[model samples]
Target: MKVPVKVDGRELTLSNLNKVLYPDYGFSKAEVIDYYTRVAPVLLPHLRGRPLTVKRYPNGVNGQFFFEKNTPEHTPAWVRRANLPAPGSTKNRERIDFAIVDDLPTLVYYANLAALELHVPQWRVDEDGEALKPDTLVFDLDPGAPATIVECCEVALMLREVLQVEGLTARPKTSGNKGMQLYADWDCREEPSVYAKRLAQFLEKERPKQIVSVMTKKARPGKVFIDWSQNNPAKTTVAPYSLRARELPTVSTPLTWEEVEGCERPEDLVFTAPDVLARVEKRGDLFGRA
Candidate 1:
């Protein structure tokens, strides 16, 4: 059943308010919508002008899920959408109309659809329909067995030092799961693909044993794969403050450099939905500059 609601002077129809989306935590669809509504002030800024890919978990976190690239045809007319050429498809000139979550109502609308995770590219769309230069460089640190987020944190510190030498400041965040991601806001004059590949090659050469620049799982055992590949124009990272479709409703949370260095275990930096909302009340947007 759908119910009419008003958010920031926008009228939206919210559905499945009582459905449990996080079984382990007994978190309902209403709670999810509420969380996004509360975090919109901080979250919407990161989402503004960027095409979003909604990862839907319609039947809850443990059920099957799929990614929706083109905005659904049923999207309300008031919701903003961006039409852009699909990335890396030379033959297909067809453009994808992506949903732009620029306000509280749009964010709530997706939440009601059980679109638990929102992902966006590092670059933003411009008035001429061209993608702007990437404003951030990201390193997705995925630790293999025997190496956990603790190991990722250790590597993140080293990665920070390397970035510092390049005159960049890095910010660390829990991947809302079993990894860590570090980002640096940059003003480079290079395409994201070129810059990311170059940095990946450089890091691989600098720490060949500790960091695997390649994407193969075979090479990842006991090492944190510095997934620099996500810096491409086509790729998207989990939006900061967005909820992860996990059993416990964890969030992709930003962290202080001090917290990153002090993390001895994954649990030290893990944050749930409520925890994230409270943190925002106290700390505001930690990734505001990025």
Candidate 2:
């Protein structure tokens, strides 16, 4: 069944409103659409001008999922799109028209499709199709065996201290899963990937045992791997306030420096869809600076 929903005076057709997307929490598609609509005021800013790669789970969280880069042909004509050369490819070769979620209707349409996780590149596309310099740098702190988000927090604090020494401020957020991520806005002229790689190398050199910059699973035991590779122009991180495709509807929530230091475990920082909406109502966009 399909229903026409009006958002910001624009009409959109949403289907499967009653279909369960999170069996554990019994979260329906309608709830997901509503969540995105409520969070759009905060979420759209981060996504604006950035190309989105949606991870869709049409059969719900437990079913098969796929990543979509090109905007679907059936997408509404009113939705925005950015056509650019694929990252790392030669100019004028292999272009992809990526969906740009710049409005409430576009976001709601995605949510209705069970595109639970929204990922966006660090850089934005300009009107001339040139990729702008990334304004944010992300460090994905992935924990290894026997390690948890607590260890990631420890590493994040150390990273924050290091960044502060360089006159940069880092913000923390739960990965909506087992790890934590730290983001800092960059004002320099260097490319994001280059800067992140150099920073990761420096940190790994400073703390060889606790921090590993190499992207190898074998070297990750008992350490937190600083996934600096996510800074690449081709890469995307989970957008703030987006839902994770887990058994429960958990959100990627921003955190204060105090909360980062106070977290004893991952659960303490995990926020559900409702929790995130409430948080936005109270704290506003914690990542607004980034």
Candidate 3:
């Protein structure tokens, strides 16, 4: 069914309201849009002015999915677009027209298309649509098989201390899947990836049994891989508060350092859409300072 709605004075036509996006939980497409709309207050700040990459699951999580870097031709005229040089561009496609979801109307439009996951770079674009220097350093802690979010929590605490010595405060968030990520407000002077890689390597050396800094898959089993490569200007990590296109609608929810420290099970950090909304209502934006 097609439902015409006006969101923040922008007219939008939403469709497939009853279609189930998460079959296992019976979560519908309409519910997905509702979740984003309710969570948009805090979610917009992180997305505003940033180049967005949307992972669209048109046929639900069980079906095929595609990552959309370029805004579709049918994108609403009011939805802001950022024209920036494509990373590793081919001859025909030298630049990418990325959608900048700066407000509620734009966000609801994307959600209408079943764009479950929104990823953005560490840096925001200037008024001229030029990419700025990285302002945040991120470490994507991914656990290989036999390791889980519980293990990631232990490593996140270790990372927090090491970053504290550098006079930077690290913020923690679940990846909404099997991992977690820590982000720190960085000084824009130096390249963030260089520092992130160095820190990752240092931790890997100091805690060889628990951490793996390299990208090699063979070394990851029973260890949490500190994926420091996502700090690059071209790289994008999943936006906080955005839902993951998993079997269930899990959100990339922020956590208090206490929650990170106290986590003992994999499910302890796992938060679904409903859980996240409730947390937001109770605690507000946990990552607001970052």
Highest TM-score scorer: 3
Q: How do the residues 1-290 of candidate 3 rate in per-residue lDDT, one tens digit apiece?
A: 79999998989999999999999999999999999999999999999999999999998999999889998798888888889988675445788899998999999999999999999999898887887788889999999889999999999999999999999899999999999999999887567888899999999999999999999999999999999999978789999999998888999999999998899888888899999999999999998865
lDDT of 2 at 56: 98
lDDT for predicted candidate 3 compared with the true structure: 0.93
Please identify model 2 stretches exceeding 4 Å from their true place.
Answer: 87-93
lDDT of 2 at 207: 90
Candidate 1 lDDT by residue in tens digits, 1-290: 98998987888888889999999999999999999989998999889888899899999999999988887678889888788889654446478888888788889989989999999999887865567778888889899888899889888998888878878888888889889898888787666567666776787787777777788999889888888889877889998888998879999999988998898877898999999999999999998784
Looking at candidate 3, what is the lDDT of residue 277? 96
Give the clash count for each candidate: 0, 0, 0
Question: Which of 2 and 3 is ahead in TM-score?
Answer: 3
Q: Give, for candidate 1, the lowest lDDT window spanning 10 residues.
A: 87-96
Q: Give the per-residue lDDT digits (tens) of candidate 2, residues 16-112.
A: 8999999999999989988998999999998988999899999999999998888778988888888877755433448888888888888988888
Descending-lDDT candidate ranking: 3, 2, 1
TM-score of each: 0.94, 0.95, 0.98
lDDT of 1 at 80: 83
